[model samples]
Target chain A: DTAVSQTPKYLVTQMGNDKSIKCEQNLGHDTMYWYKQDSKKFLKIMFSYNNKELIINETVPNRFSPKSPDKAHLNLHINSLELGDSAVYFCASSQRGGGSGNTIYFGEGSWLTVV
Target chain B: SQQGEEDPQALSIQEGENATMNCSYKTSINNLQWYRQNSGRGLVHLILIRSNEREKHSGRLRVTLDTSKKSSSLLITASRAADTASYFCATGSNNDMRFGAGTRLTVKP
Candidate 1:
């Protein structure tokens, strides 16, 4: 089974439109994260949730909001998306404690293109 | 802010040759991990080296960490064409883990 999975492997939408991507991990992990990869393949952490609690929130704009209904799920919603929003979004999960638990497992990724 | 920065944005090598990638982080870390991502695919965990360890080996991959310098290196031996992909270094401190821009490696068959 896929350990970490995200919906809409690919998405294309017009400017000003709102879109949401859902993510879930079956690994029974306590922490989940959302990362954005730009055209240059620079991956940046947008948000991180530990056991449904917001832990890390980068300098991303308010247009980007992350919601975690439970520890195994974290979703991202983009409001009034701009052309700069075109990038690949990745969902990942990892255990909370130290040691090997720090290893992160990533989903296939969702490609978003805002026109 | 990104914690790690990989040296040599890109690398090319022939099969059977070894490829080395270096990573430097700004802050102290609990552990450092290397991940490989193919074109249009998600990142896959390669190996992890903790702050207390200086070297680790898994198969043909070797990882070294120097907490004093806050840097790490990943060496891949006997490279194959299938190894052509982008490699990333991530630094984990407490609950926050950050990734670098990554090194794009092209292994010519």
Candidate 2:
């Protein structure tokens, strides 16, 4: 079974178009995160939720919003997407937060390309 | 801003050779982790080294942490073609964890 899964493996949209990517984890983890990997392969944490509570919110713009309906699902919604938003989005989860000896599990990443 | 930064940016080696990637971080961390990402794939956790620990080994992957220097290194011995991927280092603090830019490794057969 895939521990972490993300929908819409590939997405191509135009500017000002809104899109959403869904993520789910079956590892029973308490912490879930959304990361953005740019063309340079630089991975940056955008948001993190622990047990459905927003814990870490990086300096991402308000256009990117993360919602966690429960402990098992975290979804990312982008409003009025821009060209700079093209990147691979990864959904990851861990047993808990703070990285206290916990190994993060990542999904097969959703590739987003804004035209 | 990324807390960790990987050195060399990229590495090329033969199938039987060894690959080494270094990571340097800005602040103190509870632990450091190494992850691998294949082309068009997600990052996979490889290993982790704690602040109190100096070195750790998992199979052919060896990791070393130096708190004083605020740096860590990941060494993969007898690298194979399948080992070709981008290696990243992550620094985990109290409630935050950040990843580096990553070093792309190409192991030619």
Best by DockQ: 2
DockQ of each: 0.59, 0.73
lDDT of 1 at B107: 98
TM-score, model 1, chain B versus true chain B:
0.97
TM-score of 2: 0.98
lDDT by residue for model 2 over B3-98, one digit each (tens)?
Answer: 989988999999999999999999888899999999988889999999999999999999999999999999999999999999999987644678
Tell me which residue pairs clash in candidate 2.
Answer: none
The lDDT per prediction is: 0.91, 0.93
Candidate 1 per-residue lDDT over residues B25-79, each given as its tens digit: 9987778889999999999999988788999999999999988888899999999
Off by over 4 Å in 2: none
Two-chain DockQ for model 1: 0.59
Give per-residue lDDT, candidate 2, residue A13.
98
